[model samples]
Target: MSNRPSPLNDWQRHCVRRTLERGGVIAYPTEAVWGLGCDPWNEDAVMRVLALKQRPLHKGLILVAASVAQVEFLLTPLAPELRQRALAHWPGPVTCLIPDLQQQIPTWVRGRHASIAVRVSEHPVVRDLCNTAGMPLVSTSCNPAGRQPARSGWQVRRYFNDRLDWLVPGELGHERKPSRILDIRTGRRLR
Candidate 1:
């Protein structure tokens, strides 16, 4: 990652960080679509996201980070080659599921699985949101179940309206679709 700050201005970053700290859900742009996010450790926030999506808790959520170091606790235990493989596609749009072997991630984020999906995003707004919040944020498509993921801020507002605490200003990256998901342990593409 670069030493420079994220494109989000100081005030926007401050508000985003504060919202996450207060367990408020936010909507921001991602690699291919707008995303809803909140502090992953806050069950209330996570549950709120599930509720907004009309998604069952068993469906799980993805965690978006500013850097690999933000997820070292989950990555450190993997075999070196496996770790390398997972790292290679990151700082970009690929989401990979790593075994939550120690059960470190909350059940709300991991759902019924023994793994959690994560990505170190290259999207400026995503990195800014995660970095401003000082941790990974629960990232799910900003649409109710069965709806197409929102591709613009206007669509995000249409889908969620006043329900979101803050809508971080930004645009989607160049990716034409959502990140491809893979199970790192099995090399299987889940999406």
Candidate 2:
């Protein structure tokens, strides 16, 4: 098997970044399947993703970042030892719920909670997109509320059609399951 990335050209990356910059939702491959993402700070964009998935806002969404530092603000409020634990497990597929201090996280991103779900993604395109777009992205499985997540770009298109502003071309990673979401404060595996 080749290690080559899916043919996502520089131009397409730029286009997707611009779309997110303008508060548009995009579909892209993740560790397990294709995911729909938008600028977490953009309430309207986050709503668009929720509407696309037929997901209730109160269920919340995950924020994927290029690096732990990109999402450090949310975890900083945790106890020093807890913060270290969250940091130690990151730069991977684990999503951790961290307390959102400063309340800087948008309600749309955190939903009806005081904590935010966040991960420093190991996927190359996701990292590049976050680094280029300059913020964490609202990440959610690409499909309606009850359906299985789309596993390929074709599947993403079938699910969303023209609803997505951009269908970012890429291949899913080798993981068979979604990231294991952990509640860092309680040591509970939420999903």
Candidate 3:
């Protein structure tokens, strides 16, 4: 067995960095499956992800992060209870829809929703990539809306070889499911 410091080797990180710097879309491992991601601030990159998924822009997307600070700019003023509730389940497989501040969030990122979906990811490669990129990334499953999510780099390549600018090889976490989503304001389960 190899004793690499991470699941991603240096070459993979290099590719991830280059793709993100150029506002490109990448397929990478996530908590339960592969995910397509791009700079949240890059409209073109975000559009590419939507196009690759054959998804409608009005459907919006989730932003995954290494920490709450990565996504703080997109959130509105929150009550202490709401903030605590959100914090309680973060750094894991739970997504929460927080009130959008509107000022920092672009229409493309927010879609037609009044809130933005954000998750502090527990997946190592995901967290490292977000932290390295220095911003939250627009994240969606690496597949067409009606299809199953890509669970491996080979599957990602099959689904988006020409469409995606890069692919970061890594292993999915132990979870056999997608993240659970909740609306902070209403405490409603959205997924």
Candidate 4:
């Protein structure tokens, strides 16, 4: 596994990073499905994600990170236990709904919710993508609202059909379902 080149070759990584910096959306593999992602801070890029998915803006989005450190700006203000609670699931497939107390997350990502959905992904491609991007990327299943999430690169191409700025080539992780979402405050499962 260590011999693998962090999912993308240097040149491929560069192009993807450049595309993201320019407010472009990309499709990539996640734990159980292909995902659409863009720089969460770029409203235009985010809007394009919603448009591609034919999803409503009010539905919000998930932000996937390479590590907990990338999101310390949002996590630092929480109670230690709550902070640890969210951190404990790091570099894995659990998505936690953390309170946006500092309001650091933009409304476009938070949508109508008071909290933000975030995950520290275990999938190598996702982690590498986030690391290369130098921050979290907005993550949502790569399919139209009513369709099943794409589980293969070919499926991703069929759904987006040259629409995405880049498609990171990789395989999905060993999971049969999307990450389980939990509300950090209530320990309630949301999905």
Q: Best lDDT goes to which candidate?
A: 1
Instruction: List lDDT for all candidates, in order.
Output: 0.92, 0.85, 0.84, 0.91
In candidate 2, stretches whose alpha carbon ends up further than 4 angstroms from where it belongs are 1-8
Clashes of 4: 0
Task: Please give the range of 10 consecutive residues that has the lowest summed lDDT in model 3.
Answer: 1-10
Cα RMSD to the true fold for all candidates? 0.9, 3.0, 3.2, 1.7
Task: Write down the worst ten-residue block by lDDT for model 2.
Answer: 1-10
lDDT tens digits by residue: candidate 3, 46-152:
88888889999998999999888877665437777878778888889999988885546787888998888899997888887886687888889999889999988
TM-score-wise, the better of 1 and 4 is 1
Ranking by TM-score: 1, 4, 2, 3
* Model 4 lDDT per residue over 1-191, tens place: 12445878899899889999999999999999999999999999999999999999888999999888888888988999889889888868999999999889888889999899999987889988998999999999999989999999899989989899999888899989999999999989998
Across 28-117, the per-residue lDDT of candidate 1 in tens digits comes to 999999999999999999999999999999979999999999999999988888888899898888999988888999998999999999
* Residue 188 local lDDT, model 1: 95
Which ranges of candidate 3 are over 4 A from the true structure? 1-6
- Model 3 misses residue 37 by how many Å? 0.2
At residue 40, candidate 4 shows an lDDT of 95
Q: How does candidate 1 score on lDDT?
A: 0.92
